[model samples]
Target: MEGDNIEKNRWACRHVLPLYASLGMADEVERIWKVCEYDPRLEECTAAIEAWGKLKKIEEAEAVFDKLEKKLRSPSVKLYSILLKVYAQHKMLAKGKDLVIRMAESGCAIGPLTWDALVKLYIDAGEVEKADSILQRAAEKKSGKPMFSSYVALMDQYAKRGDIHNAEKMFHRMRQVGYASRFRQYESLIQAYINAKAPAYGFRERMKADNLFPNKSMSAQLDQVNAFKKTALSDLLD
Candidate 1:
């Protein structure tokens, strides 16, 4: 009977924790975690850590991570990725770097999730070059492509810098990886052209091909691009 009760508690931890966490009920999550013999499975621990992360409770999340680490033989890459995401969310660059080193020292297989988290950490730290370098390395590896959001993050940064060349590169590379272009991606690319003071010629047609209609803000930006093109033409004629 004791064993059965323990099993039931474990099951509850797995299912109930994330639901409560998502609803921002951290107290209930903590209570449920404590009831699970403190031997919760990876999913439960992940949920608890994510819950604490959402609440900006870094130490609490770290405590959960430390506890989870003690129960596993080989360190779990997914667990490390989750914690790294928390660090990224809070812009804790130093702690995130240390965690990456720890993952390497522990011989954790760096997978897609880990790569995505690392990229996000660098991006959030305003280290776009480092993030791009990591993204390139991930692409060169056999593990997998970095997540779609990683590509978009770099694209957004490049757009901000008026880096049309690299922004377009990221956009094309994103498509080369078989990820379909979305409205946000197009927005980033168009913003790059706008920032660079270049006309996004035929972009409307391109959007038509992709079946995307611009929102009001994008329409205004496109008008600005057209005005720039006309001004450039006037300069050439002068």
Candidate 2:
């Protein structure tokens, strides 16, 4: 062992790199990665992909993705979606879009989570029009499929954007598609309506149409909600 050259230890380095990563020694893992004769295989790539994502080293994960050949990149739609979600979690919207295109080019079925992620990223980026466009595309692409998450994300996006009419329209469409509105979505729309003061008539009509009302106890809850929302808004302004 005293006469061992650095080159002679490369083989051992390859075997121990993953162990280092597993032990949370990211810097050591990177050091070994740079010096080791690491062969890029699907299993290794997959493990690196997962490890980098878990560590929130998104750029490093993207680097691993770049090393993989297209043929061995993602053998199934599920894995592709998993990686896309990882990109979305990093707020890498452009990368997510490119991955979606790649999944489509490979003839993979787009799952609800992928669509939901796209919609959310667009919304978070304040690209409401683009988000709407994506929803339209999703409607066409997955016709006859129930996508409750997608619909809910879109509705939340519109509500957050203060597009109550469009949000209401989508809410109706969701009901038509047999999706019951969640309480969060309902509260979001209600809060948006109240904040904007755009038209209480429509809000009142819709609430009545949906058989929802502010009873005495619910009015108390609404008062507290309004107070909290006002405080939050004030804090943001301050």
Candidate 3:
């Protein structure tokens, strides 16, 4: 064991804490904390905050954050987001929103991940418009490059609400953005049609038109379906 105190603390923070935290070994973290100094002024604070988050030690998280704020004028966006996620995990939506406000006041721009967590909170609370607004803001802040996930969530919500028009609109808008289309989005659109009591034939046709179908077998299936449509359903059976 090296007698260097700073190196030992750094090693423990960088390596030991994360490992123990992943394994849910809070006792090991505490053992290391007792033997070595825990520096609140550096990135090492992340390990402790994350460890506390894993353990649901909200008070401990607050203590580390207070120390970090006292030592360094403001915590990093990453730190704020990490703690916010922890609060969200605990269903502390009020506290999580409060922290986002505080993080903004501290001059850290709310990034996509931070907005995603807050959007999740709004969605879970049945605040669709609120979540939609947050996602719009997230899109605006990210230079009009909305995360694919944002569209997926909105489509899911619209489908659940049976708002087929809006769901289709979102799908089209995502394509207009020139983002590479994903099969999941196509599947969601089809499901939305089904939810709205609309025939999904148009969507299946569009999926083929967009070249978004998954495999060659789907093409064969589509051919057979199209041929069957040319013949009356009763005639095909006869």
Q: What is the C-alpha lDDT of each candidate?
A: 0.86, 0.64, 0.69
Question: Which candidate comes out best when scored by lDDT?
Answer: 1
TM-score for each of the candidates: 0.83, 0.60, 0.69
> What is model 2's C-alpha RMSD?
9.1
Q: List model 3 lDDT by residue over 27-104, tens digit each.
A: 976665444334543556767777777887888777777777777787777788777777866777788889988988
Candidate 1: 10-residue stretch with minimal lDDT:
1-10
Shift in Å, residue 227, candidate 1: 2.5
Stretches of candidate 1 exceeding 4 Å from the true structure: 1-26, 209-217
State residue 57's C-alpha deviation in candidate 1, in Å: 1.7
List the candidates ranked by lDDT, beginning with the highest.
Answer: 1, 3, 2
The TM-score that candidate 1 achieves is: 0.83
Alpha-carbon runs more than 4 Å astray in model 3 = 1-22, 32-37, 41-43, 141-146, 159-163, 176-178, 191-198, 215-238
Each prediction's number of clashing residue pairs: 0, 0, 0
Model 3 misses residue 75 by how many Å? 2.3
lDDT of 1 at 67: 85
